[model samples]
Target chain A: MALNRKVGFFKGLKYKGGGPMWAWILHRLSGLAMVFFVGSHIIAGFLTQQFGSDVGIAINIVYENWIFQLVLFFLVIFHAVNGLRVTLLDLWPALLEYQRESIWLEWLVIIPLYVLILFTVLKSALGL
Target chain B: MQKITLKLFRYNPETDTKPHYDTFELEAEPTDRVLDLMEKVKGYHDGSLSFRRSCAHGVCGSCAMRINGQNMLACKTLVQDLKTSRITVEPILGLSVLKDMIVDMDPFFDSYKKVMPFFVNDEPKPAQERHQSIEDRERFDDTTKCILCGACTTSCPSFWSNDEYIGPAAIVNAHRFIFDSRDKGAAERLQILNDQFGVYRCRTIFNCTVACPREIQITQAIGEVKKAIATGSLD
Candidate 1:
């Protein structure tokens, strides 16, 4: 039965999907962030070669900022850890039933590592 | 008994320009099932309120709808389990909604059909019946629990994006037979699942796994199907 009452895009996002859903959304966002970062990195390199070294240096200053590094670190670490969780579940279907627990475990690995990353980044940023 | 506000997503093609929520405040026990609340609404409040329910238990899968925010069988989901007095009921996401809490399941079933859900054994029928080792039977045991509820499929992001993606329920069904030791149709089913709109479309998002009222490990089953496609071995 064809009906015009399809789920609107934003409405679909509002569903009470649990942790796995959030994981998926974050994974997608982190992946896109990585892609954007890589593209910008390449563009910065190109600008340095074509325009001048000053343009690249300016971009590097922004990138090397502590806030930017923390955000980038978060995106990279979350993406990798979540991707690993997905891969592990994919490889072992038996763990599928523990999908929720796996997400928690993913966070277990992410939290301390992220804290350490934060400590390192902040220490370096502050020249401590 | 607590008075709870039940908000249902209602749509009528003939009467309404767009879908709207109809809220009914009802006295209900926390122990009462969402289906019981729906029954009260249909019985006392609105006769025209449309939904599908059969085997009031979870077996039929007819009562599957979005309860609060998660896809669940209303009969199986008690109000106490929700922990919130304000309950929001809507049709499962992704599929075209036909009316109040009912969606066009044809597309869902069409995907199911593409998976060749039935057993295909070209081999002659055995003397008594085709025998299967316990381990062989156990290989597909999880997927066999699927009640063909569109819950898993409709909840899937891939299925939401593209209906032709042959959603998780179908893959679970395909996995049912693909791993069957007695079934001779794994090759054909695998070929069907290897299409562009097939196993590769799955992004390993566990929405299907969570949405499954039958508690089938849907993402795992899809992963198994993908692995089967990759390895070319059902073993």
Candidate 2:
């Protein structure tokens, strides 16, 4: 039953394509993720500020870990790319079809760039 | 005195197997309404055709249907004013077609109900008709002008995606009560509307404003809801 369900999920994913519907779903998902990250970042910043010049110490204590830094980096990149796409679509709805194509292009550009940034951050963090 | 053709969408989910368009040619008067032409076609041509209309002056808002690819009150659309001689009339978008021109409005009404469209104050009602200042009442006046026409909601892409979205019409209605000084449920209403699929779903699409027959600035009302959500104050 689990294998069948996993196959059904992949099949659903395979049928999806770039369109207004897809853009809307992506926008909502990205917005939710971005809001969550921003909230946590703000709260962490506040905690650090309250704790004094240990600001770097505060950040290091929580986010100096590789996993957290990687997650934050990916979240920022995803939010920025999705936000740019939404801004374009909102400004000129006539370009909606073209924007759908550009969204895929953005993923192509963003995924590799993010991976590179993540690699660099991880390497420097580990002093590799 | 131009002869025009109207392609009317005809279907009955119970009786008909599929939807199709039936065209009718009429020598139309310049001032004749689309509703008038529909009446003529129904009376003379096809007795099986069906649609909704009442208070032909546009106030009732029961006559809203798609004309020439736009949601409009058929009674308000003058046949002569349309640029094309051939026009297509269909049911409003983002709705289930009940029959030829009628749609199932239960979904629309359900969204309104989800927003808790009535006042919810724990206090007893005042004996003297809870007096609110003119300025306080006028704040919600524009939103109150909504006639539940579904034009604004259908025009909204967000409502198109998620039919359960308490749409602009409902949000505007909720705003009516939320901003009312006498109505003490502002916080409760705000909590209901602050969900993921609530007022935040609106992407500030001006289509609602363009389609509103009552000239209500729906985008502005949605913006006000956003502001209210942000400030934690409906007033």
Poorly placed runs, candidate 1 (over 4 Å): A1-8, A53-58
Q: Per-residue lDDT for B168-192 in model 2, tens only?
A: 8888888888888878888888888
Identify the candidate with maximal TM-score: 1
What do the candidate models score in CA lDDT, each in turn?
0.87, 0.75
- Taking all chains together, the TM-score of candidate 1 against the true structure is 0.94
Q: Kindly give the stretch of ten consecutive residues in candidate 2 chain B with the minimal lDDT sum.
A: B203-212
Instruction: Give the per-residue lDDT of model 1 (tens digit) for B1-235.
Output: 9999999989887788778999999999989999999999999999899999999989988988998878899999999999989999998887777888888788888888998899898877778988888998999998889898788888888877877888888898999988989888999999999999999999888888778888777888888888888888876
* Model 1 alpha-carbon miss at residue A51, Å: 2.0
The best candidate by lDDT is 1
Poorest lDDT segment (10 consecutive residues) of candidate 1 chain B:
B209-218
lDDT of 2 by residue, A1-128 (tens): 00010112232223222253355455666678767766766767776677655654565576657788787677677768877866665444334435446668778878998989978987998888
